[model samples]
Target: MNSEARNQHVGKVTHHELKQTLGTWQLWGIAVGLVISGEYFGWSYGWASAGTLGFVITAVFIAAMYTTFIFSFTELTTSIPHAGGPFAYARHAFGPTGGYLAGAATLVEFVFAPPAIALAIGAYLHVQFPGLEPKHAAMGAYLVFMALNIVGVQIAAAFELCVTLLAIFELLVFMGVVSPGFQWTNFTKGGWSGADTFSMGSFHGMFAAIPFAIWFFLAIEGVAMAAEEAKNPKRSIPIAYVTGILTLVVLAIGVMVFAGAAGDWTKLSNINDPLPQAMKFIVGEHSGWMHMLVWLGLFGLVASFHGIILGYSRQIFALARAGFLPEWLAKVHPRFKTPHRAILAGGVVGIAAIYSDELIQFGGQTLTANIVTMSVFGAIVMYIISMLALFKLRRSDPNMERPFRAPLFPFFPAFALVAAVICLATMAYFNFLVAIVFAIFLALGYVYFLLTRHQRETAPTDALLEE
Candidate 1:
């Protein structure tokens, strides 16, 4: 065949072919499911830096940013509706360089998030079976979830919906069970971490707490990444984005307030199992509430663990299909119609991250903290680029079909952008080592993309535009 003919054929072969099986509710499930674990643990870490009040202030600010961001971001998802999510929007808005950075940041965000969650899952399991090793359980969780994802998208979405509902119900039950133990003094004790109200130390602590505050809504954007798999991208994507964020906002505040009020907030601030630990005050250590939390709580972590693995695999598949990563990673399973290779590749990365602390210590940071910081770094980068893309597309593609427009226009998106930049700066200042490592990774990936630019540039045009 001639070069043109060969290119045309390859275009057809390489185009993204993800199955569309997700309905509006399923899309909501994936969005909520991907971040439900945040309700279980990570947010408490904010208290370690800012105490209860300071962290609440930080969480409120972060919540505003997320609300604005989701509003602005849904416009892009509805209009573009590609598997690449931010990568697709960036590509359309700013071309190849922007796309690469966005995709790299997304890869970092989605890929690293799972390891942190896997560790949390391990902690939950270890709470139940005292003899079980956390790391072993983490590896087992990865293997099991990755396999479920490879089976089929429909099946995976169904499981996600089920587990997410159970997780939501569990949180409500927790709030009821702990409400009787609520004590204002307990919540406010050490609430400022010894910094006088509005002092510089308190300000710095609040800044340092941004990442943990972000934990409440982190990866909620993964809903956009599932656009290509949605049965009705335009309608369902918008519904999912709005409903998912609202559900998360309610849950985040409810859990944070009740958990803090139930006992000394400081005690649960930096632990892997905050809810159960807090419950120890109301119900004894061996109480039924604790037992239920230890067992049923696993569903919350598993929901996110399973959901994020789905997200990261699609991200990997999108990048690989775009020639940003190895092409084989883009292949869909013949029967399952899933990106099995990409799923397994992400599982490998998550497993490796889980063991990185023991395998190779870096700056003496624990594996969980390092991975969480790394994931936050990636998320902030994506947030900045995605917000910027919304502005750019407005200017560059003014006539593009938008099923949902952000309410406040420039102001809302601009707020989200500025907030994201601030959060990024704060994380870099507070967690310089993890920020440095993430920067190096992004730099290396960009350099590799530059070296391979010619290959991508010469690839079939249809495949490049298919996204």
Candidate 2:
């Protein structure tokens, strides 16, 4: 094969054969794995138990925003199917400056999200074992999944497929067990809170809970970054996209509505990991099934971490190829055909995050949750940029062919942008310091960009540039 043709291939996927590699089921697995991993299960239950209606309202709002955002991206990806994701799309629409910011923000999102998932997995494992230190457990989880990703795409895909199937079964079973315990009164009585006398305070508190609810929907778009790796990306992508989203929508609504009816809000509210809480309530004791469900939930989190790393590394590779990062990050291993440097970089970031949390624990603040919360703030910023990119691209490239044009054109983008702004507004209101710290990181990225510009323009950046 010529260099150009070879460059377009992934594993056995030749330029012409890329479309044949993915059947509908495999693509659906990828998308569902990306969006509705193990973590989604517990969190959905927890948020539902907190303020079921309030949380559900926020969930729907975020889903609408993300649907708009993903549809816009689908249009962009179909026209210019690059692995860098929003950064590549932004670069095409708004040039290098916009691309650089989007890439930098995404790097923060990708780097922090994996560790956060690891930390969650570690916490759940600690709950199960009570012997493991959080950092050590997190490291083990990170190492295991990082190895899976670095081995090659097929291994990663297989792991994701297994985890996705297991997670779905786990959710269905939890729903079935908990169905008998749901309480109708839980959904009706003072369903709203933090407001007195039916005042605006109640309205504000309802909106304030957007982040906790929105977290469930945020993983959906992650599938887009895997476009280049998928066989038949153009067709497989939309199929997975629609199906994965519909699945989550149904699951979220069903879990929230039924769980709200089945269990008391206060019963599930105090728990961070709600799936186990629901199982414990439903089972009434620690049975083998309960243990199995808990472990499966933890597995789901690990699988999610795996999916995030796989997709994010591709973003790193694509950005590296486009000159936004060091070219080594773009290198695909000769045998593995994977971005080894990017994977290592992702590993380093995850370790740094865990280490910093350990230091805070040593300081007696136990600030790991706070640190992860900052990452949520950073993710919100990325969401804002993505929404803005949609609007900007619509005006800049109206003529570009889009296999899936975002419904209602500019209006959808505008609505999503508004919702993103609302989420940011709430983030600032509730956690202004976290928002400030997150912004400082963005500023740091900008400084890094300035310092590296000269090198990116002149340096060859990789010794193994050819392969």
Candidate 3:
């Protein structure tokens, strides 16, 4: 081989490969950790839009969409097994532009969700120490979790598993503590967005609640990003995705229903501390159980905040490695075999977002509400692209090896695709201002992609970087 070709081969094949040290259960940890926090908060906001009963209807529909999406999305993850997740599948299906869009949307989802969760962590801490500012607590969370992620994926996943289990246990404790106070009247009062029946008013509220309903399963799909690190992607991916969705569905419904029943659901409708506050209705504000919920509740937020940091880092690394992003972000730590630079890059965005929550306001939405909607918008867009990729790959590469075919094939993917489109439309309509902000982000990112395209095409350092 010529010197140039040999150099290209070595650079592509030998340098900066991510360590594949994750197992099926560890993958499960990361999957559940990514979405468990949704049950603790966010979903309650749907109650404001749709009330308890109406939000439950919205939640059920969102749950169905997620169920089908996870089942179908697994096919792509098992087959492609790239750290870029949906970006890899879309690129293989369409091309560079498809890849850039998917990567950017996933970037928006993972990058924005953490800052929202981090601020919640800070807010939770602020209640305990009146002197501490929530943003300070939030910025501290970013520093700690980003360091954990940069250290190593295996260690990060291990910590994720421990915290995830603890979070689940604490949520269960919350439900049990509040069960006695749960009454039918309390939950049903002011339900259906205060409508006597399912009217046009109720429809408006249900559609408005789409983003918050989505919160219950928002980042569950992030498991796809971890496929490259899984000890057995083909075997572990399906197990983690399927079981993770099921776990989250049961928990999401249980937590929301129980909390609503515990008191006047209206009071819980628009707050980040619904679960804790619901427990307070039962045990009193200063009860020991309330204190436990305040302190232990943080694990739910941390699991997601930490796990998403791991996710966005891998995505940035994958996109950069493929030359869609600056190649420096692709470099893995030589000793740790983790994408350290990618982790820090994502951290910078998240911390900036954490600080900007108070500074940036739109349509009367707070940082948590606005960013939650923004992340949901990114997620639904990515979901639609991913499902399209599944259909495209099936026809384009009929000879590809099949480990886990999406069950029911066309029907499952088609259902997921349609639901995602509807959700995206309704969310955009209801959150027009945030939608505009999201679009501007994509426009600028695309401009950056166009500028970088030529350099990567002519550069042969990665002769077949990802043809």
Candidate 4:
């Protein structure tokens, strides 16, 4: 087949539609549910790089960045509500090249995140059941949640709400259970990695800790991807985005402070099951409270695992519907009204990532850190592009209807852009291998686009419901 013929045939392909059934609360559920697992694990790695006080400093800075970014991002989402999320914003601002990069970065961010979360889920299960291999358990989790998402968005979102609520309740219960053991001295001890005062090494550690601190609220922006499925995105997107960030900020700070105060803090620094481990300091290793935490805490991981799968699938569908990826992936199940092909495609990549990490060793480093760093690399790229899109749109399309304008305007987005650049540079320096791998993936995506550019140009773009 000639290139022009292939392009014409691709243009003739039909696109399936996503159903709109989500309301404000459901949107909040998905946003919070997507990131709630950060409370359960991942953040502890910050302490491994920086001490307690150092990690706290990093956390505060990251929290500020997210606060500013979320506000600015909400404006773009409401103004151009689409499942493409960052891709749509960049497309409107910069054209196909920019759109392709933004979409690829988002795909990297959402696609890589689940494998890391899946490992944590396996760790939680392993803590409860000694016989369960973490890898096997992680694969099982991928199968179950991907199936749940494939069933339907409403059912998936409803499940997310229930599990997110349970996860929040468990966090509260953990604080109450461990409050008696909390001591100020424990948190402050070894605060600067045993140094009497801060030094250049401490400063570097703070920078290196950015990705782990990011884990606390990494995929919160994913809420914007649900805009197409949202009943009234203009109103509900802003409400859900704002409320969800506030909720996560509170949980992130609460878990960090309380978990540190409850024990040596160093012990849980790099562990997969930080919450249950910290609880052990208060209620002995075999205590009933600890057991309850181990079992219930699994819900936190499940919530995020399930919610993020929903996020990545929508992103995949959006990209395919717009011809950035294969159009067949944009197809929805007639009965379920879900993007089953996209959901399954993302699941295959996630599950493969898990096995690849286990079976293949890289630079003598653990799989979890590499995967997490790769995801952070994608996130930082997305942040930079998305923030730039906000600025470009304001100047390029002043008359655009913005139901929710970012309060500080240019300052907020500028701050986020700078912060994202710093974080990206820091991660590249500290995790050169993962950064290289991410760059390679991105380059390959561009190459693929170049080879298939004709098809995208000829393809019908109106099929996607970009509001």
How would you encode candidate 3's per-residue C-alpha lDDT over 216-329 as one tens digit per residue? 988988988888788999999899999899999999989988998998777888778899889888999899998888889989999999999988998998888877888788
lDDT of 2 at 361: 40
Q: In model 2, what lDDT does residue 331 have?
A: 74
- What's the lDDT for all of these models? 0.88, 0.67, 0.87, 0.88
Model 1 clash pairs are none
User: Clashes in candidate 3: how many?
Assistant: 0
Better-scoring candidate (TM-score), 2 or 4:
4
Q: Write the per-residue lDDT of candidate 4 for residues 1-467, one digit (tens) a residue.
A: 57876566556443466899999999999999999998888898888878889998999999999999999999999998888899989988898889999999999999989998998788767866889999899999999988998898999999999999999999999999999999989998888754546777899778878888999999999988888899999999999999999999999999999999998888998787789889989999899988788788888889888998998998998888777899789888988888999999999998898989554347567887778778888889999999999999899889889999998878999999999999998988888877888898999999998888866755554433233
For candidate 1, which ten residues in a row score worst on lDDT? Answer: 458-467
463 Cα displacement, candidate 3 (Å): 11
What would the per-residue lDDT of candidate 2 be over residues 206-269, giving only the tens digit for each residue?
6756666665765566676777677676677777777777787777777666655665555665
Per-model TM against the reference = 0.96, 0.87, 0.96, 0.95
TM-score of 2: 0.87
Position 186, candidate 3: lDDT: 84
